[model samples]
Target: MSKQNFVIGLTFVIGLIVGGLAIAVWPAPPLSTPAGHALSLRVPKNRQLLDIAISPDHSLLAYTAITDGRTRLFLRPLNRFEATEVTGSIGAAQPFFSPDGTSIGFFSNGFLKTTSLYSDGATPITICAVPGTPAGAAWRADGLIVFAGPGATGLREVAATGGTPVMLTTIDQDAGETSHGWPSIINDRFLLFTVGKHGYDPRLTLLDLETKDTRPLLLADGGGFVVTPSTLVFARRGELFAHHLNSKTLKATTPKNPF
Candidate 1:
């Protein structure tokens, strides 16, 4: 098959595998009761959903979909059925919401950008140029954004509005480290990220924003998130695992357990 045909076929197979998934929001407590509901996402015919992110406040959901060979971001309010296209978000991917939920940060055309959700026709404001595809990013509470840039090691940070990005961690090549990405900020002083190496499982690592110290929490296949102050959730082989964390000390208090 031709290269274009091969790409299309691959996308179709991926869509078939992932399209049936739905977003389920479980309510706090009442584990025996069915207080949660699934959000059935609607994608345009022939388009495939690329990524999805919920707003910090849980009021809106932003996702990227491939339409007519281009990818763009779409905003869907939790209470509404229709999803609205985000203006100037063409080529967007791996979107993350700002702390206030009034704006979104995304990667588009080798640049890290942000756009306001409340604006009538807001254009994306470029923050910095990234050489390769970013693994993931997080918006910090202190008007800064941390991201795993396309590089061999370490992470970078840039101002929320727009500015030059600076390296946030040192390269640990002696440990056979290849890349660092999938940053999840856990308050102003702590962060969670994935440390990757060739031919090995990715390590879920923690970083001290103040001291620049890092420690591996566990082996994971993908990035992780700080679901709660004391709960760190990560993915491995299509299954989710949770680690009990001491939020104040930034340490893993228990072994990895299935979530």
Candidate 2:
């Protein structure tokens, strides 16, 4: 071969070998573990525990415990497996965490109250005066709390710093939406709740917070919890079920069979 052609051939062969070695030595991307680990939670023995809430960071668990014939709030670190009672409160329930996870908002007696995870006292934010009891609550990132209002009136919201709550949405009697309750925020702009005349007829409804418009999302509902931006878990007739949802467009897909 000519001297020039031989040199070019040798360089091309060397370049092919280097490229092969680089491909073989490069690391593959890490895979995420989709399986869950089993951890048995030790619930309170005598107290009827209800309305459990986990923190945004998944480090803390809060729930309502009916002990000594009075409802109270309890919190426990998930790593420790022990529960601590929240003091300076008179009957509390339906606990939800703030965006930062440093504080919790709950319904106490007839008012909405907020208490820090590291503090010993709770401060009332507004007089909900919910007859019978409050059904559900959700806290927003912008320091506003949406909760169930008195006597199936509708949903109400108040500043986290304490103020009079303004009505957010009310049931349309003409449409047969007799009452509204059990609210859960699907996103910053939309809320998921139940609206019906009776317990057996509760239906899942979506509310647009920005425009104050409401619509039905599911025909049956007990309580709806947002598992992800595109998924929701709801309870009905003592059974749990889930559905795929498009939060951006306020649309829900076919629900899976209840488990």
Candidate 3:
């Protein structure tokens, strides 16, 4: 073979080998394990741990423990199995991690707070204050916060940066036979968690942020915990399902007593 052709062939083979080596050398993302490793011996029994939330990075787990009819936020490391109380405030509900995992967003004292996990009393920044109890909280990918509460007319959206929250849902919008509870941002749209007489008919609906075009994602399933525009993880009955935001596909990924 000619020297020119031989040199070209050798270069191409070297490039292919280098490309594979690069991939092998790179580090992999952290893996998430189930939250019941340490409690295997102590409290081998698990009950309905409501309002479970993981840090944005999936490093921390925050959930509400409804013991004796009172709700409190518990923070536990997602890696090692151990639970701790993060807040001692009255009526603390729905503790969620910030998208950056640097802080946690929760509702207490009729207001939403952003607390840093790495510091001691690092000053819980206020998101907004409303009338009812634990106002709903959901963090956006860009760090914007959205909380739901019964407004003078209906549900509203208060900014996480501390300001007025504009009403995002109408009083007339019905969920089975009830009103809508706004959850989080989905597909650059709004997702509301609504309950009715039909035994927790969670739905995945949409509203055009710019044009206000309302639509349904899933009609009669449980609500969604959306992580991105084209992806969502939702719990129905006792199972978790992954939803493709575009194709509308549902795939279950959970064990016994899921959701």
For candidate 2, the lDDT comes to 0.68
Model 2 spans with C-alpha error above 4 angstroms: 1-35, 120-131, 198-200
Query: lDDT of each model, Cα atoms only?
Result: 0.76, 0.68, 0.53
Candidate 1 Cα errors over 4 Å, as ranges: 1-34, 253-259
lDDT of 2 at 237: 50
Please give the range of 10 consecutive residues that has the lowest summed lDDT in model 1: 13-22
Worst 10 residues of 3 by lDDT: 35-44
Write out the backbone clash pairs for model 3. Answer: 157-165, 158-165
TM-score of each: 0.85, 0.79, 0.62
- Which 10 consecutive residues of model 2 have the lowest summed lDDT? 13-22
How far out, in Å, is residue 236 in model 3?
5.1
- Cα error, residue 68 of model 2, in Å, equals 2.8
Query: So what's the TM-score on candidate 2?
Result: 0.79
